[model samples]
Target: MTGDQLLIFLAGIVGGALRVGVPFLFVSLGECLTEKAGRINLGLEGVLVLSAMVAFGGSYLSGSPWIGVLAAAVAGALLATLHGLLCSLPRVNDIATGIALMLLGMGLAFYLGKPLIQPQAAQLPAIPLGFWSDSAAVRAALQINALLPIGLLLAVAMWWAFASTRAGLLVRMAGDSAHATRALGYSVSGIRIAATAGGGLIAGLGGASLTLFYPGSWNEGISSGQGLIAVALVIFARWSPLRCVGAALLFGGAGAIGPALQSVGIGWGYHLFNIVPYVLTLLILVITCRPGVIVPGSPTELSSNK
Candidate 1:
């Protein structure tokens, strides 16, 4: 490839990373929050799809993207709360509950999202940060959605809050050992419930970003397992919010492989490119899941440690 061609290819990769990273960022951050509180919600895939449908429907009806986002967040929180309640019950398996919630989320999204599949909703507006660039390559590289900045900001804030604040200390304690937290006169289950709900809200907002901002439309297949991948990303990121952003960008870049290849007139490997994200995810898992690698950061009471 010529110099200009290589530059264009790199620009496309960057654009793709920005475009696809938003969902992963939101979901990974949400999962991180939930995990910090000593619980896990694997039903984010369903939450994402349902939120996308609801956000689109709200936007379609009210002609207001903000309202749609709020509605989607509420819906996601409700679903997450349900999962929390079920998991909190004695003798209930959190993993099984999460799987069930995932199935339920997908079913509900499919049923309610049918009408939205045919309609076009108002898309979230983008802010161009690259006006200084006269070249097409520069412009494309800088054209990013607002969520990217928001996600990064949230990650920084959350990391600070979790590491430096009193509330963060309590959350960390609760997740590390529920019995110990209770011994210290803290409400373990209560903390987990609140965290799970907040996580759900963020995940819902992430889903809304898909319909209202990124793709700018609602459809039955809007999510495509992005939520599940986000869960994996949290593990790969070692539960650090800042690391989540980097992991999201990596996943997003992998996802851009097919389009980037096509742009360069390489069509035969399109299907192979589609698997890049999953392959990268697996690689991350293998590298991060060593016996001692993730243990230092993981909640001590968490079952995944075993």
Candidate 2:
């Protein structure tokens, strides 16, 4: 490749990173919050699928992308809330409940999304910062959706909250030891239920971003386990919201490798390129899972690190 061609390839990578990272950032942040409350919701994959369906259907029906987002959030929260209730019950295993919820979410999404398969909905508008750029390459590179900045800002805000705020202290205490939180006159289950619900809301929003912003359409296959990947990202991030953003971007960039390569007329190994993100995730898991490796900023109560 010539110098200009190499630059173009580099630019494509940057654009791809933003395109891919937005969903990861949102989902990982959600998972980070949920995990901090000492519960794991593996049903996030189902939540994403269901949220995407609801967001698209709601937007298509209401003629507003924002409404769809709200609908998706509500759907996600409902699912998470259900999971929270089930897991809180005596003799109910959280993991089993998560699996059941995942199935339920997928079934519901598929059943309700049947009518929305072909109907076109209003898509979210992208902020065209790239339009101001004189260079075509620069313009293309900057033509990302607005959600990227929003997700990053939220990550920073969440990090600060978890580290500095009184509520953060309480949440950390509750996650680390229910007994400790109870001794402090706090309701541990109640706090966890709230956290899980909030996590669901964010995850649902992430699904909306996928349908209304990135791909700009609602389809059954819109999400290919991105929600599950976000769970992995939370572990990789050590439950830090800020680190989740970085990890999300990395994963997103990895996910974009195939498309980016194809865009530049490099398609010899395109099929293999699709596996890059998953491969990278596995490598990260191996490295991060070392015995006695300190997860310096993780919530003390999280089971993944323990």
Candidate 3:
């Protein structure tokens, strides 16, 4: 490939990393908080889908993208709360509850989003950073999403809170040892429920970004399993909030390979390139999940350990 083509491809990947990584970043950070509280909510896929629809619908009705984002967060929190409540019951598995909720969320979204399929809602504004470059491709690549910085700041905030707050200590204690948490006079279930709800709220923003910024649309197929993949991403990051940022950008870059190549007039193996992110996910999981090898930061009560 020519130097100009190579530069364009790289630029596209970088831009895509910032763009696509916004959702992955939010979702992974949310899952990290949830898992840190001794509970796993795989229903994030459901949360993501439902929020996307709600966000779009709200934007269309209210003529305000911000309100749509708020609606999405509320919807996501409600669904996540239901998952927490069900799992709190005796003998109810968190993973199983998540699976059910995932299906439920998707079904509800599909049924409710039929009308949204044709509507054009207001989208979040983009920050243009490409004026320095004369090339149209470069200009397009530099149009970063406004939510990206917000997600980054949120990640930093979460990491700090997890490392140095009273609530953070309680969450860690509950995840590591339920008995210890109980001895400290804390309700383990309450902590987990709160964390799950908060996580869902954050994940909802990711859904908002998906519909209101990047893809800029409301559709059943918009998510494309990003919510599910985020579970693996959290694992890959070893539950570190800061690492989640890097992992998300990496996943975004992997996802951009196909489109980047195609943009440069290299269409061969486009389909194969499209699967890079998934392939990378499997590879990361395989490498990290070794028999008899415990993940250092993983919650003790996580179902994977049990």
Candidate 4:
């Protein structure tokens, strides 16, 4: 391949990492927060699909993508909050409740999103960063997702909070030892529900980014199982919010492999390349979660719960 084509392929991967990985970053961060509180909600797939629909529909109706993002966050929080509440009930299993929530979320989205399939909604604006270069391919590759900085800031905030904040300590304590939390007179369930809802709110933004920024559309297959993949992503990151950022970009880069290959006329294994992210997820899970191996920085209650 020519050097120019190689540069284009590399640029495509970098661009995909930013554009496609934004959703992963948001979702993984959300999941990390929820797990830190010692609660697990696996219904994030439903959250993504439903919020994507709501975001698109809201943008289409209001002529504002920001308004659509707000709607998506609200919808995601509601669904996640429901999961939190249900799991609070006696004898309720978090995993089982999460699965049910997933089904409900998808069902609702499909029913409500029927009309949104054909409508063109306002999309989130992009910030061009490749103006320094004259090449069209480089310019396109460097257009930053408007929401990328927000996700980065959130990661920094979460990491700092976990390290220095009183509330962060309390959440970590609750996850590590319910007894310790109760001894301090805090309601375990209350903290967990709050975390789960907050996490859902963050995950909702991931959904908004998917529809309003990257692919910039609403569809049944838009999420493409990103929600479910996020669970493994959280584990792979070992619960660190900052690490989640790196992991997300890695997944994004992996996902970009197919298009990157095509960009350079190496399209014979396009289908195989598309599965790279999933394959990477499996490898990460196996490596980090091997039998009898204790992953560093794992939440105690979360491990026991699983």
Candidate 5:
């Protein structure tokens, strides 16, 4: 690659990371919060899809992308709340409930989103931070979604809360030892339910990004399973919100490689690049799956920990 090409490629990667990482960032953070509360929500894929559809529909109807985002968050929180409530019942399994919710979310999205396939919706505004760049490609790449800053702040806030707040301590306590939480007369179910719902709300924003920002469309296949992949990402991050941000950017860069290469006129094996994130996911699981190798900082009550 020539100098200009290299610059363009790098620019593409930076842009792609911001765009692709938005969903990963939200989903991983959501999973992190849920896991910290001693619950797992594997059905986030469904949440992502359903939220994407709702966001698109909302934007289309209201002519405002922000409204769409709000709608998506509400939709996600409701589904996640249902998952939390179901799992709180006796003999109910979190994993099984999550899976069922995932299916339900997808089915509902497809059924209700049939009318959304061809319609256009208002897209989120982008911030042009690369005005100094002479290259159009670089400038284009630097046009980032407004939500990126919000997500970054959210990560910082979550990390701070986890590190230095009474609520965070309670959440951590519940996850590490329900006996201790119960001893304190706190309702473990209440904490977990709230965490799960909040997590779902965050993940729903990721879905809104899918429809109102990058790709900026609503379709049955909009999610591409980023929701499921985020679960593994949280594991890799070891439940740290800041680490989740880095991991998300890495996955986003990987997802961008194929498209970046193709933009430079290198089309061979483009599909291979598209699968980089998935391949990375499998490799992470394999390496981290060793018996007796407990991940430090993981919640004790997580089934995977047991």
Candidate 6:
């Protein structure tokens, strides 16, 4: 490619990463928090879709994207709280419950969001990061989501909370050992449920980004399994909030590969290129899930289920 073409291609990638990575960043951070609390919430796929519909619907009704964002977060927290409560019951498997919740969330979203698919909603505004450049492509690619900065700040805050806060210590303790937490006179279930709910609230914002930002519409296929993909992302990020940011951008950039090439007039295998993120997810799992390998910073209760 020539210099100008290369610049456009690279710019497309940067824009795609910023736009597409927002959802991944939010969902993965939510999952990271849940895991840190010694719980798993695979049902976030459902939370994501449901919140997207709710956000869009709220934006359409209120004519305010921020209200929609709040509505989405509430919806996600409600569903995630249910997941937490159900999993807390005696002998309930977290994985099984999560999968069921995923299906339920999707079904409910489809049914409730039928009208939403056709309506237009107020969209989240963007931060024009390309005014410094005269190129239209540069300008378009540099329109960063307003929520992107919030997600980044949340990552930094979460990292600090995990490293130097009392609440963070309790969460870490709960995830590492239930017996130990109990010995310390704390309720493991309570701690886990609270963490799961908080994570869900954060993840709801991810859904808001999907419908109220890039693509800026509501539809059944809005997610493209990005919520599920976030599980692998969290694992790849080794459960660190700070690391999740970079990992999210990498996956986001991977997603932008096909679009970037197409923008440069290379449309061949455009659909196939979209699978890059999935392929990357598979590679991460295969490499990390070896016979005797231990993932660094994995919560101990994840394996023990105690």
Highest lDDT: give the candidate number: 6
- Clash pairs for candidate 1: none
Q: lDDT tens string, model 3, 1-306?
A: 998888788889999888988889988988999999998999999999999999999999999999999999999899999988888888898888999999999999999999999989999899887778778998898789888989889999988988999998888877888889999889999998999999899999999999999899999998888899999999889888999999999999899888889989999999998888899888887987788777777888774533
Clashing pairs in 2: none
Task: List all candidate RMSDs to the true structure.
Answer: 2.0, 2.2, 1.2, 1.1, 1.2, 1.0
RMSD of 2: 2.2
Off by over 4 Å in 5: 304-306
Candidate 1 lDDT by residue in tens digits, 4-68: 66666777788888888888888889889999888888888878888878888998999988888
Candidate 5: deviation at residue 264, Å?
A: 1.3
Error of 5 at 21 (Å): 0.3
Over 4 Å off in model 2, which ranges?
A: 132-141, 290-296, 304-306
Question: What C-alpha lDDT do the candidate models reach, one value each?
Answer: 0.83, 0.82, 0.90, 0.91, 0.93, 0.93
The per-prediction tally of clashing pairs is: 0, 0, 0, 0, 0, 0
Instruction: In angstroms, give how far residue 37 of model 4 lies from its true place.
Output: 0.4
Order candidates by lDDT, high to low. 6, 5, 4, 3, 1, 2
User: How many backbone clashes can be found in candidate 4?
Assistant: 0
Which stretch of 10 consecutive residues in model 1 shows the poorest summed lDDT? 297-306
C-alpha TM-score for every candidate: 0.93, 0.93, 0.97, 0.98, 0.98, 0.98
Query: Ten residues in a row with the worst lDDT in model 3?
Result: 297-306
lDDT of 4 by residue, 105-177 (tens): 9999999999999888999999898887777987888788888999999999999999999989988988899
Reference-based TM-score, model 6:
0.98
Model 1 spans with C-alpha error above 4 angstroms: 135-142, 290-294, 304-306
